[model samples]
Target: MGMIRFALAMAVLLSHLPLTNVKFIGGGLAVQAFFVVSGFYMALVLNGKYTDRGLFYTNRLLRIYPAYFVMMAIAAVFLFGFKASGTATLGMFEQAYTNPVTAIILGFEHILLVGQDILFWMKIEPDGDLVFDLANAPPAEDKPWAWQALLVPQSWSLSIELMFYAVAPFLARLNWRWLVALAAASIALRLSGYWLSIDLGLWQARFFPTALFLFIFGMLAHKALPLAMRLPAWTGWAATAAALTLIIFLPLAGLPDGAVRWITYVAIAAAAPFAFHVTRNLTADRWIGELSYPLYLTHLPFIGVVLTYEPPMPVLCAIAGSIALAILLFVLVDRPVDRWRQARAAGKAGPASTMAAATP
Candidate 1:
């Protein structure tokens, strides 16, 4: 599962790289897979270990903030520095930040927007196009209600996940029937929204309800894990292969962007949890998983910096620097914090902790 996560993060990174002929896989699909994985783990831990709300919130804060703040702080420095030197105009800066610390201080909204799947209002880019409009250009006057881009654009996905963590305890408690119904409802709503031609402003593709099914699949996977394990390991490999095939080949087949395309994404997401279940307890896999978050969080920012230099080996520099930074953060920040979290949880639970953990 960890290895799978690392691969998904890499797929996203590859998709972003300013290289030719490299985007064979969809990074967005990988992110969808991430939500599913998160759904499984959050449900597993919240249900088993942090049933208490205060403790659960504390753990989530510790898990997300320490590292997130570090990244945001670095972003602020760059943004402020560029502004102070008059290298960039104050207008965009003002739109992105109220003050240097405001984004970090009031990050709760970003977390909540994740639940709604709304990041800020969609704005027109300087390039005279809407963000994420890979092919088409929009009318110049069209803009978002409000937009925030002081930090790396990729941070939006994490905000969505944080939103999920906020309500995961309750979500995890729902019966299988309800979970499935909710998942179906999420998809149906998005499809209906599309069918009706409702124009959701900027990053409309990111609407929370549209993607909630992936996470629900993850929760359902946890419920089905015991049965999944009972199956032959080859089944896991087959599911994984099918998912990778869909992610890589479907777009190349040049299917029109409609129901078929969307269904392909849904099916790929559906296959991921089963693939995740069978790949248990390998040290190599765990190490990759541990590195995945760091890799995902840091890559785009590093690339942003690297792009400024216009280096001949831009991709090489970005990948290397991102990997080095990820390794350093994992060692100094992520690993230590995780150990402390485990230690504290253990001390609080005493002998009963193992029994609780054993169930997951």
Candidate 2:
């Protein structure tokens, strides 16, 4: 699973690399895979790890925020700072709004916004031919969708993850029958939008109940994990190879982007459980897996900064810098948090054991 995740993250990183919009395994598919895999892992943790909702949520936050805060800080310095210095004017940042201090504050503020709800109501008046309308604007309309509000545009997926985290405990508690029903409903809702021509847009796909099905897919995968683990090792490798091939070819096979994506997610979700067995004890794969989050979170801004500077080997430098920063974050931030979580869990277990011992 770790190896698979690293591959998906690399797929995203390659897609975002500066030189080309080369679709080497669609980034969108990779993101859906992340959600699917997340669903499965969260199910396992909720079932077997912390029973306290507070601890679960806290662990989730710790897992994400440390590196996230660092990435945001970097974004503020490189992206916002450069924009504020009046050196580069992209479509995303406005010249009048170029106060570096304000940009910095707003950059942090955006992370707190979480999702599009508060920003959806905002309407930026067009002054001097710049139109900023949050509700109806294109995803690339930066004046309304500034780094100040989004921090990192791609982090929108994190907002969806937040939504999933909020309800995962309750969802995990449901009986298998109920969970299956919920999954069916989620898929139905998404398909309804497609059939009815409702123009549901990315919001419907990104953070909707329909997306919940992917997580449910994960939950189902978890239920099957024991059986999956019993499969021959060759099966794992074969499924993984087939899934990757499908991911690459599906988009180019002349289907609509939406259809291609739907197929890709289904294929990966089916294969992910089997692939998990393949990497169960692989150390290097796990290390690269741990780096995947930092890579996903920081790569865009790192690449953007490099492109902004037009330094020699900017693409190469962005890849190197992003990987270097990801490894640093894994060591300094992510691993420490993992140890803290383990310690906290052990402490909680100790108290429970002592109480049980005393009662007997």
Q: lDDT winner among the candidates?
A: 2
- For model 1 the TM-score comes to 0.78
lDDT string for model 2 (108-208, tens) is 54666365333332333323122334244543333343433444556667767888999999988888788889989987887776555334554455545
Which candidate number has the best TM-score? 2
TM-score of each candidate? Answer: 0.78, 0.81
Off by over 4 Å in 1: 79-91, 94-119, 122-148, 195-204, 241-250, 258-274, 347-360
Which pairs, if any, clash in model 2? none
Task: Report the C-alpha lDDT of model 1 over 36-147, residue by residue, as the tens digit.
Answer: 7788777667656764677777877777767766766665665565432112234554533544343443355444334223434344344323233322234243332223
List where candidate 2 sits over 4 angstroms from the true fold.
83-113, 116-123, 127-149, 194-199, 247-249, 346-360
Supply every candidate's count of residue pairs whose N, Cα or C atoms clash at under 3 angstroms.
1, 0
